[model samples]
Target chain A: MSIRNKYEEELTTVFNKLIAMCRTVEIAIEKSVNSLVHRDTELAGEVIKEDKNVDNLEHEIEQDCLKILLMEHPVASDFRDVSAALKMITDLERIADQAADISEITFQFGEESFIKEPFHIKEMAKLATGMVKDSVQSYINRDLELARSLDRRDDGVDNLFGKIKGELVELIKKDGRNADQAILFMMIAKYIERIADHAVNIGEWVEYAITGYHKIG
Target chain B: MKDKKQTVKDNLDIFDFTSDIAVNIKSLNLYYGNFQALKEVSMELKKNEITAMIGPSGCGKSTLLKTLNRMNDLVDGCRIEGSITIGEKDIYAKDIDLSALRKNVGMVFQKPNPFPMSVYDNVAFAPRTFGIRKKAELDEIVETSLKRASIWDELKDRLNKSALGLSGGQQQRLCIARSLAAQPKILLMDEPTSALDPISTGKIEELMSELVKDLTIVIVTHNMQQATRIADRTAFFYLGELVEFADTQTLFTCPADKRTENYITGRFG
Candidate 1:
């Protein structure tokens, strides 16, 4: 094979591995959030362990991309894609960390049943998962419009998070006994909100890959 | 727009050329979409010589080169205003045929695009397209073109093989040969060696020096070292403006413009 073909093959393998890592983390976040709301410690443990695997994948892809940058000295669209992949991995790794944080919280309250509805927390997870999936899809397809659209959706997540904080304050004021649990629940909501924000960062990187610009929307 | 800028240009006007010119641009302006790239740019290309266009990225050096061959016409919404005369005929004249103009002017891109064909086919395709026929004629043209590009010895045995099989430098040289096979009067190379290794770039620089004997060549390059090696004259551009034009030795050694000196001495782009 030609040198270009060899580099392209390596690029594809690394990119596919990155996308797989994102997908695995997305699933982990989904199940871990469910475990928190539904009081399933076992599923939370699985999500924590899966995040370790995601970390390894992130490191592997990071090295592959750095190797290409140092060796081939690519330009134009190919250069853009390689750099975007690096930035995307950074955000993806952060998303996995948020998922792991949820798992840790779930493990902490293993004995106590999840009393609160956590409806707002569940919505936050769903939005975050959507962001991760769309961000990676935009990167894969070089879809500038969809990638930029993540910013608008991010505003929605932020708004919902603010409302959740207000509701938790009301819950704490209503009953003194549930105050500690309400604060823990608020921390979980904060982590999920951050996951969504990191997803937006990935979206920004995808746009950068396609257009060589960093701004979203 | 400012009086101080006008005063600086008055000094630039002192530099003059009084001789035969292969290309004479009189107030050329180029536009893509709504943004103007070249603004009333005027310069002369001396005949049968290597003139290097040097500038930071997006300074309209490539735009000026493209206009010489009318490659700007390939871009949608790109409008060229004012006269660009090649060999004393208006290139923008309504009666001028684009294909014939392109036959006289050829281009090599920054990256080597060898048309996904066999090594022999890449050199022969253009001549054949322009109405050259017969096995003896094609073979002769390919041999001469490759020899001129300085890749004949390396590629002579693999003439039937795919161009994709060649090294990056060899493929790029083949691209130059393909352009030469058309027998163009002027060759426009846009950073040809910016894609190759140092060794490959050295070979190309040597080939360019040899080909200067017969053809008028205009090259755009970021490498200051490559320009000194092959170019006879150099033009410096900054922000879509032609800053200065002079002999290669003089430009590199004693540039009239501060910007040109800064760019060459590794202080700035």
Candidate 2:
């Protein structure tokens, strides 16, 4: 066998675990939103439960990265790949946590209808989950252009979030009794917005891995 | 012979020419008979910084290091082309004195090669040869050079003892002190720690970092980790060609050339 065969195998394992974690987080985002839209408390419970699996994947990937650093003494692109993986996993874990947060809020609603149709909020969820998946793909492929394009899509998600917040304020103004439900919807919209922001963070890290240039300080 | 001494003195005075660059090689190509060892290699080594040359065996990293001090002149079939300027003087010029050039550019080999003399005499050898007879001056020079090499504290009491009796690490540091005794403007190291244990390697690396405060260092090392640890800039050579040269951080993290990436990451055969 070649000298780097074992190293390459270990690197491949870390990459595969990252893909699996991305998929799990993407599913959690989708299910949490679906549970609210369809009033399926069972689906919300599953998202919250599956969060442990996402956390475990993050821990495993972290260990793999640390081992590569300690043993291989990796340099050049290998060094960047491992360091970037360390940063990207944190964003992924935060995304999973936020998904679980949304599900917990869904449990708060408890058989009552959303104050609004959740139209703009659901749009935000779809866009945010797509950002998460595509950002991980950009990292895997080392695709600079795709990583850059996610910034614009994040702007789209932000605009939808602003629109939802304004709508919630207007609903609360229309009737004082709408305040409680409007507040819950606002929190859900905020979590989806934060998820999109985390996705953008992942994209920026991909840029660092490929070009060593982070978008912000 | 007196004329030669005056010329060497003149060459030594030129080292005072202030410049950020200590050595500049333009379009350098070296050959050993019919075999081309280095092709069109051009690099500027900054003063007071360590630049590391790394590549697979026989890729011309050591050949390039030897060219810095013209040590290749000892090789029977070796021939070189292009200009290598140290400070403002072209070292290959006919009037250039080889002894003065060697004094201005000191070298340490892969293995420790302290003289069979005592530690004090080993550090004092160069100064005495250059015509310092006073014991007081030689004493100061020996003490200063040993301290600069960071081995003075351990060997201070053992000054009268033969250098060959020291441990491998101490012997390497003594060799370094011997080089510093000559007060060279540049130091060329060829795998200076490859033969030593890890602790000794670490000591030599620490010495290099400290020594760079006063001298420009160009080191040829096969150990990539050593290059990354002590070198500010690194050059990657492959098959007589310079594949890439950049800041050590950039070269290791995101090399511009695929060849460099593959080589540094150990993906190459």
Docking class of 2: medium
Model 1, span A1-217: residue lDDT tens: 2336776777888779877988987998898898898788888889888888889999999999999877765544556788889888988988888888988888777577555688988888898899989999898877889998998999888988999899888888888867777778888989988898888898888877776567744
Candidate 2 residue runs with Cα over 4 Å from true position: A1-3, B1-14
Native interface contacts kept by each candidate, as a fraction: 0.00, 0.74
**Per-residue error at B166 for model 2, in Å?**
0.7
If you superpose only chain B onto the true chain B, what TM-score does each candidate give?
A: 0.90, 0.95
**Candidate 2 chain B: worst 10 consecutive residues by lDDT?**
B5-14
**Per-prediction DockQ:** 0.01, 0.63
- Residue A203 alpha-carbon offset, candidate 1, angstroms: 62
Candidate 1 segments exceeding 4 Å error: A1-217, B1-19
Q: Worst ten-residue run, lDDT, model 2 chain A?
A: A107-116
Q: What TM-score would candidate 2 get against the native?
A: 0.95
Instruction: Tell me the deviation in Å of residue B200 in model 2.
Output: 1.2
RMSD of 1: 17.2
On lDDT, the leading prediction is: 2
